[model samples]
Target: MLIGKIENWTKERNYAHPVIRRAIDFLDETDFSLLEDGKYPIWGDDMYARIMTIDAKPRAEQSAEKHERFLDIHYLLNGEETIGWQSLACGAEPVRPYEEEQDYALYGALSEESLQAMKPGMYMVLLPDDIHRPGLSETGASVIRKVVVKVDKELL
Candidate 1:
């Protein structure tokens, strides 16, 4: 997992993958206010962005999830949020089965969960091995706007 502020991407480190760079660039260049909640292609089916405005629930009310085929890039646009992450090796049981069409699967609490409070310009790059519980609030349910960019592993 890679976490950093969107504005710091150009200086913190050099990114080599074009797909990864494009995903970051998309976040930097796009005016999210002009977009509605939906998926938009960044590089055809190989990469896409999902935009949403959600009223986040507490961590207890949510389940962590992982993707099999794509790595996720999440950018927090507004509001405060706490995201939980843990190692896939932690042996947590899945609360729900994997759905191939959606490339999604849900898991219950892990052996060691780490919490991250996202700032407005913060972004996270979660890989297939990353088990993350998003859309959760620090204290209680709250509204937040974010964009998640999904990039196929083939492009990595």
Candidate 2:
């Protein structure tokens, strides 16, 4: 998993995939405040983004999910949240098997997990091997407006 401020995207773009760079460029140019909550297609099914405003929950109420077919680029537009992450190689038992239609599998808690607080202008990139539990709050439930860009693995 990778985490950074969106303001540094210009320099970070050099190390990112071309498609991811395009996604970052699109994000930099768009006004998320004007976008309604919904899925917006960028490059057909290969890449797309979802704008959502939801309430944060406790970590215990969230599940660790990993995707095999796409990388998740989570960018916060408003509010804040604490995301939990653990490496897939840690051998955490899967509570739910992978659902191809959804492209994710839910895993039980890992012995070691890290948490990061994300606020507006911040982003987190979760690869297929990054088991992540998002939407958690450090304090309590709060509303968060964010965009999640789904980049197909083929683009990597």
Candidate 3:
């Protein structure tokens, strides 16, 4: 997992894959305000971005999920949210088996977890091995607008 301000992308570019760098560049140059909520293709199915407007939920109501086929770049566009993350190697039991069609598996409560407070312009990169629970609030539920860029694992 990686978290940083999009504005400082240049410094981090060296550490990212070329495809990921391209996605970051596209996000850096695009005007998200002009884009509506939905999936937008960038490089066919290999890469895409989805604009989402979601309501924050409590920790108990949210579930930790991990994707096997893609890495998620969670970018905050408006409002704030708290996302919990735990390493898949930490021994958290899966609540359900992975759904190949959806590329995700839900996990039960994590015995070890870390939280990240994300505000507008900040982004978090979640790899396939990272179990993340997004759209949570530190105080209480609130609405937030964000974009998720999905890059195929093969691209990395």
Candidate 4:
């Protein structure tokens, strides 16, 4: 698992080492007590920067469509979460929106070779082209702390 501050991630590229190191540092310095609420804190113009409190209960399985314009820098604040990831290389079919409230739509089923497990303090940065399924269960339910920082495709 990785933990760190967002400001220290300034020099990050595609590799995970430096970014992961910075995340660890960030977690050590910040007071995450304000994250008890399920609401996300507002940050940036297009970036989704908020502390996510995932409950220790099973969550609805869902995959986010491959985004054309952002990178997802998800940092787990607490507990553990196993996120499912799929590759766009296999080709994806579009689907209807699952929850209009969240503006997230489900993508087509993926080949089994693409899933990944993410635990507490560990983070994953989903590139603009990566298809991801976040918030799943392992041991019943677990609360996960996360922050999603979106990077514009133009910068990548």
RMSD of each: 1.2, 0.9, 1.0, 5.4
Model 2 lDDT per residue over 80-133, tens place: 888999998988878999999999999867788899999899989899999999
**Tens digit of lDDT per residue, candidate 1, span 1-156?**
989897887775465477788899899889999989999999999899999999999887888999999999989999988888987888777789889998989988677999999989999989998999999897777899999999999987
Q: Write the per-residue lDDT of candidate 3 for residues 29-129, one digit (tens) a residue.
A: 88999989999999999999999999988899999999999999999999999999999999887898899999999986899989999989898989999
Write the residue-wise lDDT of candidate 4 on 10-114 in tens digits: 444335554333433454455677555443323344433556665643434554465665566676666677676766676766575445454344685666435
Ten-residue stretch with the least lDDT total in model 2: 20-29
Give all TM-scores, in the order shown: 0.94, 0.96, 0.96, 0.65
Clash count for candidate 1 is: 0
Candidate 2 global lDDT: 0.89
Worst 10 residues of 4 by lDDT: 39-48
What is residue 46's positional error in candidate 2, in angstroms? 0.7
Record all residue pairs in model 3 with backbone atoms less than 3 Å apart, i.e. clashing: none
Model 2 Cα displacement at 133 (Å)?
0.3
**Backbone clashes, each candidate:** 0, 0, 0, 15
